[model samples]
Target: MEITDLTPAERRVWEAFPRGDGVDFREHPEDSSVDGAGWGPERTVRAEVLRALLLGAGRAEEGRVAGLKIKGARIVGSLDLRYAVVDHAIRLRDCWFERKPLMYGAQLKALVLGYSTLPGLTAATVRVDVVLRLSCCRITGPVRLQGAKLSALFLQGAVIGPTAGEESDEPPLQLNHVEVGTDIIANDLTVHGQLRLNGATVGGQVSLDRARLLAPGGIALHAETLTVGTDLRAHRMEAHGMVNLTGSRIPGQLNFAYAVFVNPDGVALRASSCAIGEMWLRNCPPVQGLVNLRRSQFDLLHVPAATWPEKIRIDGLSYRTLAPHLPAQERLPALEREESGYLPYAYEQLAGAYRTAGDEAAARTVQLAKLRRHRRTLPRHGRAWGLLQDVTVGYGFRPLRAAGWLLALLLVGSVAYGLHAPRPLKAGEAPDFNAVFYTIDLMLPIIGFGQESAYAPAGWYQWLSYLLIVTGWVLATTTAAGVSRSLQRQ
Candidate 1:
């Protein structure tokens, strides 16, 4: 089929085609020459109106329909022409009207609708692999790309919807940003990507599900400065390179569920200055990359672990969603690689996680490891002395220390009484309370042996010293109680 300029008879044929659904015009070879005289006036008008209806219906023929002007055709309808082959890149620039255009469920080679002025456009299930550039176009609807596949899609600098209005210049119900691409850049655009919105304003969900970015140096999808009113979901998106989102403000959740980021040099989600509602990065295992959220703000859930190996330096943050599933040993590499100052902090969280999981032995082991690391920096004597005290006096452990202190005080008092004060009646001998009383007489020796004066010299002096020691102990115990309570609560 060859496409020639529209003649008066050809125009009549186009007009004769039904304007309703399930109607299509046959494909003919498109004349590359830009000759308007061939189609004339009457034929041009008929072709223009018919072309609008066909494109709107997704019923446009594959071959070519060139040299025919079809601008500002207000055909309120939906399009669904899938697997249509176009030899040349199609152009639909600056075409306006009220309707939901369905380009989804279609397979095109190349599209060039750049600088096109459109209002209320919706395309879902569309598949284009070559190049689809709609740069700087004004669209007033949810330009949805639900389940679409594009090689290089460039909607750069395009205005998705109007400001100060909820009703999109087009219509609502935009599907998610579901595309597999070599280079897909939709930066600085103001409109939600995931859903068909009511207004042209940027407010809805954005999903980049199962999308693969094949680029190496930079990211596959670049959506910076996107002011979302709802969630920005990127589930199962595999990027072979860095995914840089320098500055984006989201009013709702920023979800990266099960996303694989393969950037070792750079980060996966570098949202340095974003203001998110709730950030969810669930089930994202440790990657050899950074997800730096430096200076970013999140309202609710903050799963810092889910965003692991990501250099997320949050200055002013409200992170209530911090749940660690992995133990401290597993997260050390990530902490070191990211050079996070919160390494110890993350370790503390891991300890808590183990405790919460009812793994007391594991928790104790982790804590002991931390203590050993801290002890390694101390002097040898101090470390040895501390370790000795840890076993003997139980160090800071209250339950064992309490019993140990009681027994130590008893032994000291008993020995002091025997050596310093010998009983006169016994004649060169002193009643050994420790042996006679044994365990049953433990309390009597501890509290009373030093309380009374003995016949041996230095009796009053020893009694006074003992009283002072008891008083000193009471005061020390009180102070220790206060310190223990304070630390335990914190």
Candidate 2:
């Protein structure tokens, strides 16, 4: 606290604190700094000096227009200001800190540590008026900002947590229950541990485009129950662990295009119960685990055919429209990836989408696919009946097949009876033998032409007549049953 005890470098910072003048020691730190140790006296500033300056030690009233701005210096010792209220901006860019700053429950104007190297940050429940910018910082420990309220949080290109393979129990970066006013942008950010944002309420968008979240065999991003006012963009992000967004509410687009996931936990992305707007999984690489999107609702889904993961739990995913508008055949394959087993509503949802697009044929195709899947779960007799309907009339989806069967049967009956004509009944009085009309009447089951009634066939010919009648009735019954079932489904 004595002026005579202060070093030459510390004395300069002490004299300039009141005016808030920025102190740039030199073009670079005096010497090659090593964790606030190897730096010469020129660039090494004691944390007590900064704390004294921030606490208004030697402040002057005349030139009190600025905050504290120190660049390229190595701050040694703890800048401990726990629960203190300070109305000044702290900009320590391109600096090295020996010990992490402790600002728990402190109220500050701003804290910008751009391009600095710090052990970690712990500012739980802190209130900042302006912003918290840690852009391009290399933090070696967990950065906890839980329950903090700030205007904006910009972590662009920052690298947090330990180096790869040094896994820790604590999450590397956590902003859980934090409230941001504008946006929380973290593009190109890399975290070696789980990045948690559970219960975060963001007024604007939260962009994490091209961020590398690496926490192997564990959760990479745990942002459940989040409330985002706008978009939550994570375009092209490569996550090594499970990204769980179980119950988020993002009214804007939730984009994950061109992203790659490699989680060994059997599940990659879990976004169930999310009421999101447009969601994009387009152009992304094949995921290694199941993407659980159960009970999620989206206005417009932008999952192209190529981006669908091989396994999914899409039991209750409802989307109004699909991007690229592929036909049902091309899109139905995605529904097959649902590992939660047969779900009729999922098929109906797809069919409804096609119907809304005015593609009834495609809709029918989806319905048929659904029935085929249903067939696998049916009993042996039911499956046999389903197979018959499928082969004969495509479960009433292809009525032309029924017509073709009728035509082929009529021709076979006509050929058999013509080659072995039945003996005439009431000789000289019976109607003339018309092979086509007689075969048609026999197959018709109800309508009777005079030829079939007036003639009598003995032995094998009589058996053939009975066969034609039974075949006609079976075809008609199966066609009617299949058509009725199809209509019932619709």
Candidate 3:
């Protein structure tokens, strides 16, 4: 691509290219009056000029393009570099584009479009060896990076949405299936539409710190099935709609501390089936919607006990450790804070988690709380019976409770039998009427001491013996069940 092959606008841009020693486009000029100072006089360049530059860079004798700098210029027409391979950086600072640059399937070293305003950007299937920086830029239309492979993507302080008075139906940013070798930093970004990163893979961290996303009545950030090699840090992030991270696999920590989510009638954070390292939701603002963590697994969970949403779903969540430790009295109530309050397994799962963490006392407290809540769910008339069963046998959690009840019943039966002694049923029946022995014989339904058959209870003592027999059977069955559960947990 020679100067003769360039269009009139391209020819002017080529003529204006700063030629001479010590001219670097990679570094911003210090002098404000310079041509490439980034805030200097605006220059209009045709898309053909950019294509010729890339071609010239590819065919350079040294195999390196020194600098391709264009500042404060309005790039006319769509700059299509699809499949064009270049080995140098392209820097466009404080420039405006009439249309989005199409870089689909292009291979480049690096791209810097900082402080620029563009209609949109399309880099699907494009591969960059280094960073792609769009910091402080304003995009009017969607910014698509689907299937792109880059080292890092920096959009810090960028504004992605429809321009004023323009209506957009598409998402603000789409990174679906994109793979980044390093990080994706979008700190302080303001996105008006959904920011979709579904199926994306990041080798390093995905930091959206202090980002503000607004897509009311819809999803604000959808990163389902995303795989992040390192931490996914979203501290102080403010999202107006649902932020779905379902099925994501994060090998490092997921920190969302001090984040604010506001989807009143829908899910605020849906991380179902996700496998994350440490999870931090501590000090976050009260979420208006549900935080679904069903089937998710994490090493540690740090969440505010009282600030959780009323409709949290933690059916199969398994966290090895929890932070901000509260006493059992406080922890048990926190587990029952869910609206509808019918999740028995949720309590069991928490208890199991506590037991796994070597907190048996806390686990037992959780189990007791579960039994109390379960009793409350019974019918009004059946509540008393359920409470009795729970207190006497811990609803099959405390086998010792059955033993205590059995001893009390045995003592009462013995005292009654002693007061009114049994009489012999037959002549010279060996008077097998020791009060303690008679009581024991009645209590043990299967193995009798031969006293119950040899003697008969007088007056109301017979009814007392019948009560003791029924109580013994109930206690025995409950004790067996409780022991089985304890063994299984161990």
For lDDT, the strongest prediction is: 2
> What is the per-residue lDDT of model 3 for residues 376-430, given as tens digits with 9 covering 90 to 100?
7889877986776677788777767787887888889888988888787896855
lDDT of each: 0.49, 0.87, 0.80
Candidate 3: where is the Cα deviation over 4 Å? 1-51, 57-65, 70-82, 314-319, 322-348, 367-388, 414-441, 444-457
Task: Give the Cα error of residue 200 in candidate 3, in Å.
Answer: 1.6
The residue-by-residue lDDT of candidate 1 on 172-198, one tens digit each, is 224334554444444444343222211
What TM-score does candidate 3 get on C-alpha atoms?
0.79
Candidate 2: residue 251 Cα off by (Å): 0.9
TM-score ranking, best first = 2, 3, 1
Which stretches of model 2 miss by more than 4 angstroms?
26-37, 58-64
Error of 1 at 164 (Å): 42
The TM-score values for the models, in the order shown, are 0.46, 0.94, 0.79
Cα displacement (angstroms), candidate 3, residue 435, comes to 5.0
By the lDDT metric, which is better: model 2 or model 3?
2
Model 3 residue 357 lDDT?
A: 73
